[model samples]
Target: MLSTIVLAFQRWDGLSARRFTGLDNFAFLVKDPTFWQSLENTVVLFLMSTVPTLVLALILAVMLQSAVRFTNVYRIAYFIPNVTSLVAMAIFFSSIFSTNFGLVNAALRSLGIPQQDWLGQPWGIKIAISTMIVWQWVGYNTLIYLAGLQAIPKDQYEAAKVDGAGVVRTFFSITLPQLRPVVLFTVIMSTIGGLQTFTEPQVMVGNSGGTGQSGMTVVLFFYRAAFLDNDYGYAAAIALSIFALVLLFTAINWRIFRGRSEDR
Candidate 1:
């Protein structure tokens, strides 16, 4: 596997490998407007999806931890999406976001609101893609958080109750602090997943990310460079750049969470 990969880099003629132009591809990527646009879109989607997903997952996990009825059934339902095929989900979402006769538009029309061309507009396409990502991953995160919540000793909550701490107070002061490591883990995982988002956007908005390339994630951009445009060297550089970005963002998340825990 390593030899095949190295040979692709060493002898690949598709990207003018005969002349080793060190950093040329990297320089082009730095100045590429499309690359920057994709980066911006990626960040926006990450923020939009990760924040809400984590918040909702935390809430759901808390509810489930309270000896709720049918807890096992709920767990299975939430985890179904994680086990389901992403490609199939993407395809399903694409049909739902169609400009005409889509479920969203039909519902809007029933409410006397104007229908939207979801996949035809840049921001709309982004929202659609982000929605899919959130829907699919929120359940998985919830399960992880639920596990973390279950691990917390019952004595802590019992003691908090005896000390006259309200439910919210105990949650904020006790539950949240204990879940810091789990939260950090989810954040880092989401960061890595968000940075490499490709299929939903690609399948939903097509190759160029619909209007103005709004839904074009960095991964899609890399795919285009390497496969569609046949620029192997540039694509490899973009891949490395993505790796660097993921590392940077993961480090930032870890530092922020670690600092917040220590501050408390």
Candidate 2:
């Protein structure tokens, strides 16, 4: 972190002599339209990815918590994406969402549905990347939720059942309230990961972040500034901005959850 802060003041291409540029890099970032675009895209992707992920993960956790055949197999299957190589998975998804002659387009065309350029268009690219994010994280979040589920005394469910509470009623009144701490952790973690998202976008869309720069996440923006543009100072500034953004969001989420916990 200190190294990044120091680098933020020095204009040094990796191979060139360092020139102290002070706040110029930061000033330039302020006016850089692409940087702002990337920031916006990052936030959009965060919302697109994280919300459905938590919902699906919670549902999966609840389903798996009930006794089921091949439960362990189901758990491992869902978790494989979380443990797989992100670059490889990104490449795989790129093929799946490929504009022409790809499986997705082929299937769509077979059904007489128009094939959209998944990675070529702005919104499509964001959706594709967000899909990858959800797939990668859902299982991990599921496990965390499952742990929280286990911690809830079995008698809570028994009591609810004795009171003639339905599954839906019990889930909202007992399950979610008890899972607050786990939800808080997942939310903050998802926020940080979403803001720092890089690999899937970079791998699927290339360094330029595809058409309209929709795949340009904040971390990807930092990578291009540092490596492709050889603007270390600017990259450092972006890095700091990313850090600040994460910190701010995490603090906000913490306060919201903490307040709820206190109220409860």
Candidate 3:
């Protein structure tokens, strides 16, 4: 963190003599259209990927918590993506979203839909990236939620049932409230993961970030600046920007969740 702050004030690549350029990097970030585009894409990816992941993970967790056949097998299957290499996963997804002969487009074509170049447009790139994000993290979030669900004593359900509570009633009146901590945990994790997205775009669209740089995320932008452009100071500013963004969102999340807990 300190290194980033220091780098913000100096105009030096990793190999160059350092020159003090205090506030110039920050100024450049504010004025750069690409930076703003990256910021927008980052936020969009964060929300689009995160909301679905939480809902899906919770649903999966609840299902797994119930009596089911081959429960361990199911869990392992879901968790494989989370433990797999992200670079490999990103590469695979690039193939899946490829323009001419991708799996996704092929499936769509089979359904009598027109094939779209998913990596060629802003929304398409975002959708592709978000899909990767959700697929990668949903299992991890599910496992965390499963742990939380298991930590909830079985007696709570029995007590709720004994008191004439239905399945929905038991879930809302006991399960969700008990899982509040886990919900908060997932939200915060999602916040971080969503913002720090890098590998997907890097491997999917290269540093150019596809058409109009739609796939350019903040971290990827930072990587471009630090490595491709050799603007270390600017890269440092972007890094600090990401740190601040994450911190801000995390605080907002805490407040929202903390208020919910207080209400409970």
**Per-model TM values vs. the true structure:** 0.94, 0.96, 0.96
**Could you say which candidate leads in lDDT?**
2
> Which scores better on TM-score, 1 or 3?
3
Q: Model 2's lDDT to the true fold? A: 0.92
Every model: Cα RMSD to truth? 2.3, 1.2, 1.2
Clashing pairs in 2: none
Question: For candidate 1, lDDT tens digit of each residue in 1-264?
Answer: 343234334324474535466556767888999999999999998998888889999998888877558999999999998888888998898888777878998899999999999988888888888889889998999999999998989999999999999988999889999998999999999999988999988888778877999998899998998789877767777787798899999999989998987887
User: Rank order by lDDT, top first?
Assistant: 2, 3, 1
lDDT of 2 at 82: 97
In terms of lDDT, which candidate is stronger, 2 or 3?
2
After superposing candidate 3, which stretches have Cα over 4 Å from the reference? none
Clashes of 3: 0
lDDT tens digits by residue: candidate 2, 1-264:
899999999999899798998899999999999999999999999999999999999999999999569988888888899999999999998998998867889999999999999988999999899989999999999989999999999999999999999999999999999999899999999998888999999999998889999888889999988888898888999999999999999999999999988988
